[model samples]
Target: MEDTMALQNDLTPVVEMKGITKHFPGVTANNQVTLKLYPGEVLALLGENGAGKSSLMNVLVGLYRQDEGEILVRGTPAEIHSPKDAVQLGLGMVHQNFKLVETMTVAENVVLGLKHLDFIPSFSEICRRINTISRQYNLQVDPRAYIWQLGVGEQQRVEILKLIYRGADILILDEPTAVLTPQESGELSRIIAQMIDEGKSAIFITHKMEEIKRFSQRVQVLRKGETAAVLETSKTTPSELARLMVGREVLFRLEKKICCPGEPVLEVKNLCASNEAGRPSLQDLSFIIRAGEILGIAGVAGNGQRKLTEVITGLDRADSGKVVIQGKDMTNRTPLDLIQSGVSHIPPDRISMGIVGDMSVASNLVMKEYRSEPVVKRGIFNYKEVAKSAKEKIDAYNISTPSQNTEAKFLSGGNIQKIILAREIGACRGLLIASYPSRGLDVGAMEAVRLQLIDQRNIGNAVLLVSEDLEELITVADRIAVIYEGRIMGEVPAEKADIKIIGHMMAGASLKGAAQAAAEAELGEDGI
Candidate 1:
């Protein structure tokens, strides 16, 4: 990057934004933001959640209109009012969430709304073009396969193909690797490199510092709504980037203490469950989450993690198993029964399973206790007590909202996560099942969630922590269990656990096999 400064001065900027401003309902998303992108380089936009990276990119792609700014494309001023306009100008964006018809083929989805093409495209010709571009970009997705049949990583490839097929040379990718596995993330890096080799410029909006160093030449740090600093990716450290993002010194690792195990509070023995398509999800899965310890379940997504959490929380039925909690058989028990049995659950789909969106925050807070004492003296609800508890929990969780009566839907992802964490951890009586507690949160919020889980474990609660983040498992959990397809691959002590060993196990190597091949895995770096 330091050596590339000469080329930056020689080559003209492909895209430039000067003094951009944008405002939302209660906050200014961006204020006087400026940026420049030259051809054949990847510029990493680094920031925390709600730091206006998305807003700036949205404006660039015509998904949002800046309050005031001048956008120049190839040294000429341009007005982009819609996605169609942006596409015609060689600008394209691959969002975090894919916009694809689940039942449609990849080829069909690619040629869906191409107004510049023939009125009707030949299916064979479309497939041929998809194959060619996919090979050229290192994005290998089956053109004939339906979107629903593909995994998250494959689906993202289709999104990238969509942009390339539309004749876009300037790409904007919003958290492209967030939903991908470690292996898939490696593939994505290769693809981006190919794009750069072909003289195409890319703007990667991400919070991952390692990715910034590996992929990008320059890094742009945004805090609140203004430019904090611009640094060469190779020169800056992760700690400095984190400080720029949070405006304070940050903790890189979790400080977890030893946990003294007591009797088992949750036992899932000989469990079996089916997916929505009647396929085996969990097969003979048996595990014990003891009191005063965190058992982290690590795996790639869709590898029976959801079923394990649901079956334990009594949200989904198990074909055959015993869910014994605190010396009581609670298999096939109703969700309310499990709740009453002192089992608190923080589900993966927080908005759908954790809280009611349209309901008041205060009402949602008291949902677990509305039928119990203090909050419910008679058959009617107690608004006063509920509000008191909600206010206290909101403050304790550092939830920023106008009031307790605000709708839950209005909160950001981090705030929503905090609300659920506060409720579940505050009321945990025996066992707490937390699944993907920090899925989409920023670093600060993620640190807070992990600390809260450790706090609960310290207070004598059996916690089953499920997450896709390997570093997080190495941080807070006392024991890490690898889950491959359905069954547990193996368990390892979290103290000094090697990530390469866990990665090998995640890729379906046996515990003993992984240990034997640990040195080999390090050299080859396979199964990561």
Candidate 2:
């Protein structure tokens, strides 16, 4: 590491931003921020959501112009007025949500926007070049595969290949591993290492602390739209980075009491469902969540987690299944029916499904109960009661909003999530299904959300937590269920769960199969 740092110190920065400042309505997104990326090194950008990391990067990528700053590429001032200019200057960004045409093949997508392409470009030449880059970086994806036919990790590799194909040497990866499985993330780390070995520099924007430690040479922490601290990754710890990012010490572990599970609250028996593509998603999946117990569903995204949640919450229909809530069969019911049956859902897409962005915070708070008494009386809404309820929830949840009347869309991601938590938890009677509840939140806000889930469990609510984060599930859930291809691969008590076994189950291996495979591998290692 010391030798690598010494070599990097001797090289000019591939990209540099000086005194970069950007502003939006009523807020300064970046307050004279500065960033530098040396050649052949990975710089991990760490920050809470809305802490100006994206805003600063957007300036460099030509998505937004800086109000007061200058950007230098290879020690020369560069004018980047659009993405085309950024690409021409050897800058490419792989955004979190990929911008690929789903119906197009990988080779076609790679050369889609190049101005130098001939009227009838040779796809054979394009595929050959893609194959070369793929072999060089060990990015294994078929060039002829369509975007929709590939897995999430393959799609991500295609995105990177697009950048590399465009002659980009400086890469910006925004939460690259957010949708990947554990094994895929490891593969991505190796790919990035190979890129750096070949003298390519990258700026990795992510919230996960372990990734920062494993993937980058130096770490930059941003707080309140300014540089808080920049430290060598080897010399600093995750706790120190958390403190720098939030301006205070953070508690990584929570105090969760032993669960005293009661009667069954939710039961899904022989459940079957199909995805939007008309393919079978949930295949005879069955589970039982008891009151006072939090049952966590752990799997890679795009597994039956989404479909299962939708079926149970009445957002989607089950082809064949039995959904029993507190001994009452409620299969194929409407969302309102499930709500009336004491089911509360914290949807994954908070902006679209959880809350109406155009509505005021107060109105959104009372959305579920607006048709009931106290909020609605004699066919009229009581504005004072709505405001009173919103005030209590805002204070209780620590939601940082301007006022109750402010539109929900104006708030930050964390605050918007808090609003959903407050509303759902307040209305929860018997069951609460939360999907990736702490996702994209800062350490401080993530801790708050986890503690709230524990609180719900302690208060005798049946909580079905579906998360891609294994550590979070192990933390708060009394028991964890591994889902794969819409079936329950296995269920184990969280206290006794083995991460290796869980990972295998998430990849489609049954519990007994995984155990046997582990035993055989151990025996082989011992030369038995």
Candidate 3:
């Protein structure tokens, strides 16, 4: 561990906020918060959703003004009233969502918002400037490529380069690697490290504990709009950080007992489906998920996983083939019909497909069964019964919300997932199709979700988990099936799965070719 005194040396904090408080109507977003950022050191702002991590940062970058507080930059009080003022004071913020024009080239997007662009600039000159900054920081952005053509990692490089080009000494990043692949994340860490080596400072806001331990020099936890604790990175553990952030000790592991499979519950034969643009997205797909077993579909994003889930759940129509559940044909049944026929679907897009965002949480809880049972008695709505069930499920799922009557859109991403899972997993069903169930959840919440899926499988309910994360698929699924270009490339047992073959399949290689390539690559690595 590096000595804290050595890391600090004689440098004072480049930015400081004392007793910051921000308020909204009927809510206090931040209350008497304090923060300090030193040059050449990375600070991780850790918290659960709505913990005011962003609110504090926003006050610094001029997005939000503190109702009561003092900001000091370099031992002097600084007043920043706008983004331009913050930039002028050598502070820059990269938002959670990148602000770039997709139709423009990288160079154009970089120079778009500068006030000095009163004169028409030469494209070649701008490209030269971008290339110089890119090489200096190891950001590796193509100055001539269109923004839409670049990958997520490359796009992030452009965002960082823009700040550096504008002569920013302090950088703020929000959820920087949320959409990055594991390899991309490694490269991003290297880039951030290089930036620190060049004497630039950063404050990274994220919910990931691993990123804090691996990337940041110190950790500051926030809980319910207040500063909870700040600790040296090498001296603290993730469990302790999570405990402080959520106000409770979090369970990090799940309990999984091996169980044997049973009769087939869902069988798809020669399934064919088309995307919204009338192109084939699922072709000749066949698989069977049995009782007490989980079948995981592993593939890169946008490789027919959505189509498969939609076809099975009756959200999208199949062009050909049949879907059989317990020897019953369900080729083109409606979504409601499938739900009533013992199928529960956790859709990919929770906000759009899973729940009604404007509706109350209690109403969304009983969406599936509103037409029947205690929720609706003799065509009359029963608010008391719905409230009772919603309260029970909310407590069971550990969802953090104001109340059952609160709007679903006001909850955090993790709580929204819990609401959907609570409604799906707790229902009476036989087949559960979970698409990206743990996509945006924190590590502790992810454990709870995986446990729920396993519990369903243990109780003889078949589960099909479609996910882009290969590690998650390996952890939960009994059998892994690789898909590519609307076709099943190969099937492998999860116990003996090889990532090289899966990566090859996702790149559109045939089954035999992928296996051969994987074997040859392995042998080459061993110097055979």
Candidate 4:
């Protein structure tokens, strides 16, 4: 045992966690898990959703206290009781959701929570320092720019810069590629490689198998709060890693075939809507979605996505244009009319539009179908019937909750999405509009939701999937439509689109013209 311990120390793991265990009220998060990270290496932590990947990382980052464990830095035991303590120990984490102050400048956000605010606030010095660090790490960002002005990718760069600025040598990235385009993801991978080359250590927390293959030297699989296996990336395939993590052979791709689309299930011509400020949001937007097809709407958030959903769902009326659903004109229809017409929506903000946060899960499950039979009783309330129906839906959706009567807010974000998905997909007969459906889900939960949506489309249901995630659009959508500045730029077949061309379009370029340029550029020297 002494010789084995000496052999392990020779590897010089920067961060070592031994026999870590954590528990919530009813669930054991980490069950005597042991993980180690070596300097100058990218260690990929692979796991499914709800597999305790985040929880274990949280323990290392001082977000949660471990019930039992010993943490070692440089092979010496250390106690990290808070984020500050973790930072003191050369540890930093970039969370899945960025924690930037939107109104603050990039430099301000990066420098936040650190002691020594210069008496005069050295804005210039701070910017210079950030720029220096940015160049050093190949993380380019305008530190003087406001947080709100930066793109999602840029915002992520800012997060990385923050840790670099804080003097952290051991960095933990949690699902960093979830919202990035393929091009951006590639850039990030290169950045990680650069870091590794510079002798910095990193623990990459992600469910993306492709990333594990591309970025990591070694891969560690975590299942149900324990380390299942750790192996060299070059020696294993994604299928093998997936099998180890899931304890079975999992299908990485969906078995989908070509579809024969029917007549227009949803038709909109010259539609207009407004934002919260009562200003024009979606301006003269026109599109058609046929039954048995998944039309993916791709764009940055707040770029008329919300208004488009509101207009179609009757939460807000379009200023103009006809909304014909199932061959019937339901223009400027009431919310009730939209629901009766077989239109179900998974809203952008699940907490605000999908679930009543303060209400019981049972009530929320039946919120959309309270007026329908079996749940309603001659204009009277049927508590028993509603509860029973909710239980059935809960079971069918595999929602994780102690009981149906549990408050919606008590459940995790992923479980809340499941409830909404179950309700909308089961109730709607013609069309389903899912916006950011898998936003915060972990691997397992995301796969389940994606499969559910694909299943809906396969059954001849028209699905309008609006998302900022381009990879999702590529995988699940038959046709991808780029939306910019409140209008549809152009539509393209999923197979014909590339990440670079599509990313340019998302950044407000003309899609048709850009596609033409891309084609021309591919033609070679004479074409140029």
Candidate with top TM-score is: 1
The number of residue pairs in model 3 that clash at the backbone is: 0
Candidate 2 TM-score versus the reference: 0.87
Tens digit of per-residue lDDT, candidate 3, span 295-335 = 99988766788888888889889999999987789888998
Model 4 clash pairs are: 49-444
Per-residue lDDT of 291-341 in model 4, one digit per residue for the tens?
Answer: 988899988775788788888888887888888899999888898999998
Give me the overall lDDT of model 3.
Answer: 0.83
RMSD of each: 3.6, 3.7, 4.5, 4.5
Candidate with the larger lDDT of 3 and 4: 3
Question: Where does candidate 1 stray beyond 4 Å?
Answer: 1-7, 103-105, 113-120, 276-279, 349-394, 399-423, 519-528
- Whose lDDT is greatest here? 2
Clashes of each: 0, 0, 0, 1
In candidate 2, what are the lDDT values of residues 342-429, reduced to their tens digit? 8999998676578889999888887888768888899998988898898999988777666788898866666788889889988899
Ranked candidates, highest TM-score first: 1, 2, 4, 3
| Model 1 weakest lDDT span, ten residues long | 1-10
Among residues 3 or more apart in sequence or in different chains, the pairs in candidate 2 whose N, CA or C atoms overlap within 3 Å are none
Model 4 lDDT, full chain set: 0.82
User: How do the predictions measure up, each by TM-score?
Assistant: 0.89, 0.87, 0.81, 0.81
Score candidate 1 by TM-score against the native: 0.89
